[model samples]
Target: MILPNSGLMIPWLQSKLDTARYVTAGDLGGEMVADSRKAAVLIPLVLHSSGSTVLFTERAAHLSTHAGQVSFPGGAYEVQDLDLVATALRETHEEVGISPARIKVMGCLAEYFTFSRFRVTPVVGVLQPGFELVPDSNEVADVFELPLDVVLDSRRFERKMVERNGQRGFTYFLEYDGRVVWGATAGMLLMLAKSLE
Candidate 1:
């Protein structure tokens, strides 16, 4: 059976996470670094009659980091926030005009480390149908959606290795609309797909 389109229904997506293993293990066998910055990202799912769709934004080219890249709506965590979930929601509102009230947060996915030293938690949320989206022109270049089915299909996900700092590392990439979804954002989605499966 296919996964539900609404974010409200994702808990039924199943829990593939091995909580014991994740919690007991440290750093997934990588060296723990002190510079790890805590961040959060919003993985907004829009349920449609056709299928559930995942939303993404193209960052403005002028941004200092990850400019013109496709990314979820999120940013670094702030001390004033209650938790990572709030950071995700606030960032989504600032970047895409998506009100926190309109989102039904399912839960958070496992944290993924970025090459830039950020440890980001992905907050999964469902957007009610008929909500309007207003992209922030200064930060977001464009907003787009991809069918959830397309993203969940294992055949479409590919792994490629590239050399960094003289060491070969692996990365995940999802191709759609002539655009590539990769890096930390894609890694989080891959984990979501695994959880759903």
Candidate 2:
């Protein structure tokens, strides 16, 4: 396992990603829907003096879908975006005011299929210190950071039985402070953690 030191984490993560056999839809017990919409999310790792932390956003309460849920900064692929990477960067900037210039993208995780029928690609990146956030109030309710160590440690996750659409199964979640991270966001985090192992 990679140590949580800021100095060691970046390169160690890159190496792990380099050799990673990325997950696929089938591996997650689902297949991509024929009409699935493409989306991207930025998994931004911020370098703090204490250690590294991951940035996340709470969606605005008024949103029609996934309202008030913890999520990465991202959205559906735009016609103007050159690719999914650009889509992730563009959405991050629009949602949290983290300019694309401030993010140094390391790699991408597998495409995560949401029950909402969006195939979301997770783009991993690192941000150096000194970046300021100017979150747009319309789409973002709050912005927060969780320590990288807490996120990467597989043992930190909590699994509970949940019934969705009348089917009972396990759902994974992570809690920090008073906030909960679950759903597709938590699934992607688990994927990253497993990849590192």
Candidate 3:
């Protein structure tokens, strides 16, 4: 399968998501928890001379939940946030210091429910060049980039069996430069990867 190239990523992604079947909770071998809280995450993609890359944040180890996990920049929905998209942009700016103005939102992927009872909406956005990061020390421990091509390549991901809350199930995982992206984050990437096919 061919992946989106540098000059064609924006339109390519938009078209793919527009027609692709969304990966709901059940499709990932899970179900949404009752009374799950709403959350949103920004899947930030950047264009570079070599190619496109996706930005991910390492959650601060001090945080109470999902601490030290590699994840997209986001958080639970707030009352004042306009919508899921707004929630995503707001949390992304707060966590990684990327201004909302610099990102062009392409579209949203299907909601991915987490074991923590949080329903997450992954918003795909492309970043304009020359942006710098200033990750908040309280929420973000580090920031890193992964090639979009590498991520979209389905062969790079591994399916593994794991137990959560006394139940065993399968999950997807991808490792890059010593950082492992798994759980809902890897699921979202796999969803996007399938779209390209």
Best by TM-score: 3
- Per-residue CA lDDT of candidate 1, range 22-86, in tens? 21111222234358888999999887776788899999999988889889999999999899999
Against the true structure, candidate 2 reaches a TM-score of 0.92
Q: What is the TM-score of each candidate against the true structure?
A: 0.85, 0.92, 0.93
Model 3: colliding residue pairs = none
Worst ten in a row by lDDT for model 2: 24-33
Cα lDDT tens digits for candidate 3, 104-130: 999898888877778888899999679
Computed on alpha carbons, the lDDT of every model, listed in order, comes to: 0.77, 0.86, 0.85
Please state the error at residue 18 of candidate 2 in Å.
0.5
Model 2 vs truth, CA RMSD: 2.1
Candidate 1: where is the Cα deviation over 4 Å? 5-11, 14-33, 163-168
User: Each candidate: RMSD to true structure?
Assistant: 3.4, 2.1, 1.7
Write down the worst ten-residue block by lDDT for model 1.
20-29
Residue pairs with clashing backbones, model 1 = none
Clashing pairs in 2: none
User: Higher lDDT: candidate 1 or 3?
Assistant: 3
Q: Write the per-residue lDDT of candidate 2 for residues 59-108, one digit (tens) a residue.
A: 99999888999999999999999999999999999999999999999999
